[model samples]
Target: METVEFKGSHDPEKKIVVSLFWTVRKTIREEGCAPVHIKRIRTSRNVYEPEGRKLLKLSDDIMEDILRDMEMGNTVEFEMTMGTESLRVLIDDKRFSVEATRTPEIEKEIVEKLEHETSKLTPDFCQTFLPRIFPNQ
Candidate 1:
């Protein structure tokens, strides 16, 4: 399977994942595909700057949670899939980690383990969620 990944230094304050998590949340809700649920997380800042890219806040508890997920060997990851394309984001460390991704066959397995569903959406969803990434056809 073809894959694209974004690797970056982890944020100890857990702000990176917070933004990543919200990105997944926004994609899922706006896509309106499979049933996916998310916690009502409080962001340090508004996602939309009104004229800029989305920004989010990282919290202490989120860092703890990421540690726990890694400790359990099941880091909190999300998958977003549309047709043949997909994205998979993983945030399991503060010192260093990766970002989001799309749902693959492992969705069921991950969901069963974390009690979290795979956030999925249609191809059209990308047009809105990531216009820069997937521009209009």
Candidate 2:
């Protein structure tokens, strides 16, 4: 699997994150992927360790809840598996990024779709990442 991280010109609001989430879901579904698992890990200031919940579906409401936790100075991470590929969204006070893995060819398609979709929605929110290095290559 190759990983792609999305960057933006500036920190995006919750709505933008929701848009990005939907874009990714649509792109992966186009490739015939099905939802496998969705997990939300929440960290709190008082808790000794973070708590995590495995959700049946990655709904819009859950995503919004994650954003709310992030706003409250809590760390929330979301991971979802579809087919053989996986998506991980990191949201915190300092950084926000979406990381996904797929075959090289599929990765290209996903990126292109994300670029086109996001451009239509807002200022090209899906930006660059580190050069992808495949071990077999």
**Per-model TM against the reference:** 0.26, 0.43
Winning candidate number (lDDT): 2
Misplaced by over 4 Å in model 1 are: 1-4, 12-15, 18-36, 39-62, 68-74, 77-90, 94-137
Each prediction's whole-model lDDT (CA): 0.34, 0.46
Tens-place lDDT digits, model 2, residues 20-118? 455355546555655445443443422122236523433345445655666675656656566776666555654444556654454445455544543
Clashes of 2: 0
Cα lDDT tens digits for candidate 1, 12-129 = 2233333344444444543555432222232232221112333222234544554555555443553434333244544444222222244343333322322221212211123243
Angstrom error of the Cα, residue 124, model 1: value is 23
Taking all chains together, the TM-score of candidate 1 against the true structure is: 0.26
